[model samples]
Target chain A: MMVACAVLPAAARSAAGPTNPFLRLPMVTIATHRLVLRPFRRSDAKEFTRLAGDWSVASMTSDIPHPLSEGQARGWLKPGRREVRFAIELEGRLIGGAGYYQRRSGTAELGFWLGREWWGRGYATEATRAVVHYGIEVKRLPGFTSSHFVDNNASAGVLRKLGFEPTGRGRIICTARGYEVEAVTYWLPARYAVQAQPVMARAASAGRWRAWLSRLAGRPA
Target chain B: MIDAIRTDRLVLRPVHPDDAEAIRAQIADWDVMRWLSQPPWPYTLQDAVDFIGSCSPDDLTTTAFAITHAGAVIGVIDMRINPALLPLRGPGPHLGFWLGRAHWGNGYTTEAARGLLASAFAAGVGDTVYSGAFADNAASLRVQEKLGFVRNTETLVFARPRGREFPHVNTKLVKSAFRTA
Candidate 1:
């Protein structure tokens, strides 16, 4: 229910002690060669309206409504408790959005949605990696957690690529489509916060070269 | 009520005022704090004082300890009631911990965690305990899974600071399963 942005500034902390007990970190921009994970711009509203308006993108996400309007996109761009929601952009056009939300206690959760056009591309992984890194290294958050509709294999794949493991599953009534769908839960620890050299090493050595080559070839080569 | 938990290479004891400096040092490291529920950046002596002062065993509902290795406090662990909700009559406590960056990757947390689970069971607190890791946090989840905590559910956490909802994976450990694993 709490919507958080990815680029919240640290200045938002109340000077009145730790009464709130919520820790918010600044937004981080993760850039790959072609994509720029940065704050959403007002100009992006039109593009976001078009992309998120698609039923394909809207169906998988929790809050997004199909036929997303310009006003809706503008509202979505507003900052939340954590940071500004980042417009996942490729070549300066908005493609998706991702950010962290501090829910309760010291825990925070990761969320993002990409347009259907960007599916199969690695932008989600790239942006997610950036946010995860910022959440751990910059915000100094404890961990990042997430879940997706069981049928959303693309989202699940993105989670796996970012090192999130399946933790559990449940059923949720989808408001958008008015149906109950199975939700798959996944989680990831701060790689730097905890010692996970072996896991990291395994992931790194697990045909990373091939993966990287495949990604390169898929690019505008 | 006072006891020392010993693992293969570490000791966890009741946190005392003397451990404030070490606690501050551990929290000051961004790496240690980043994965913690509390922001460890800008940790100061006052935070340590307040944290240690807040560790009241008399409450029984919430207990914390300083992790010691070779006579120095290097980390911390605590089991507390789920702050978001009242403790279910038979549900076990929620566990959380943070070790200094330098001491990580050496199996210290796992060792200490095992000891804590044992202590909790010995105290007859609850039939099962629950814990969680953020979706992007792989290490904490790995530790929980390694210690035999089963996945329970995924939650959309609303971080107030960022003002957004995030996905989280929750895990629980039942006593019977703990003993068996």
Candidate 2:
């Protein structure tokens, strides 16, 4: 499942070339106090398919399709894709995904989805804060813009807790529902992002070392 | 392909590269821009070129024309799909336009937009069209009113260039209503 933040910077965006620094940044792992938000690996496909295939999860997102299969999940997680996607891990298990997508120059949108079992656990909030924080602190983005289907108050609550203010109303086509849905738009400037608590400052580490260090550092198994 | 549609005093046709200069010149005026949602303040030539470059004559998503008078490019008019943002019964395109500051009061905007709407319907874009203007943009509202656009709702909408929200009037025009009214 996906939620998006799209903000095009006037000076940096051009028809021919994008000067936005975030557009050039590679997707990397970000960590929060309760979650490990890392870019998806091919092996995570099975778990991704399992969680994202649920209709309730798929309907809330803009792009996730219903009845998603492992093969489809793998294709979407392919390396070298423009948008950055993360596998949200808890207790070393892939429970959900979150990431930032640069739809055009100067602006990037944030999206995330957790397995139905993980609902109401605040995992989405943690993972989204990690990604949004990374984009602002590391990628130098000014802020993020997000939208939620009006009926999806749970998602709205996550944004509200993250300091995103409702700006207006818009619509986006939900691929799962096969129709456009009314959505409320929200914006969070980088300054507000600083106020989001528990933004754990974890460095990017790769491979077995990351898992070993995560375990050694007294985090969840 | 976007073909030229003629009115009594203006020719509406697909915007061209050469129109970039005129677009930049006309839209740079604060008086011309304060109401527009996208184009940044201090509009530039590259912005005009980019806009013109993105227009596809064969693409149904947008139909943009350089509003010309006696062969001189003065402004632009376009009808673009709302992409299902409103509560309309079926698909409907949004009407957007801007006339060069020098050309504002001659009824040219209404004339050009009317011709473009006709062309859009002929091309099967949509039967109904939706439009919006900043509540303070009385001239824009008057233009819509002149074309029989029925005021539907007023809502707060973000104008990106201005970086703030403003009350905006959402209006709709149906072919049948236009034909009778």
lDDT of each: 0.65, 0.70
| Residue B46 miss distance in model 2 (angstroms) | 1.4
Give the C-alpha miss distance for residue A207 in model 2, angstroms: 58
Steric clashes per prediction: 46, 2
Off by over 4 Å in 2: A1-221, B59-61, B82-90, B179-181
Give me candidate 1's TM-score against the actual structure. Answer: 0.45
Candidate 2 residue-wise lDDT at A187: 82
Error of 1 at B115 (Å): 0.6
Kindly list the per-residue Cα lDDT of model 2 for residues A1-221, writing each as its tens digit: 23533323323242222223322323344435456566678888888888888988888888777878788888867633346677777757888888766545434567777888998888888778767766665455556778888778788888888798899998888878888898888888655665553322222212223443454588853
Write model 2 residue lDDT over B127-166, tens digit each, in one string: 6888878767889989898888977655334454554333
* Candidate 2 chain B lowest-lDDT run of ten: B82-91
Give the least accurate 10-residue stretch of model 1 chain B, judged by summed lDDT.
Answer: B82-91
Where does model 1 sit among the CAPRI classes? incorrect
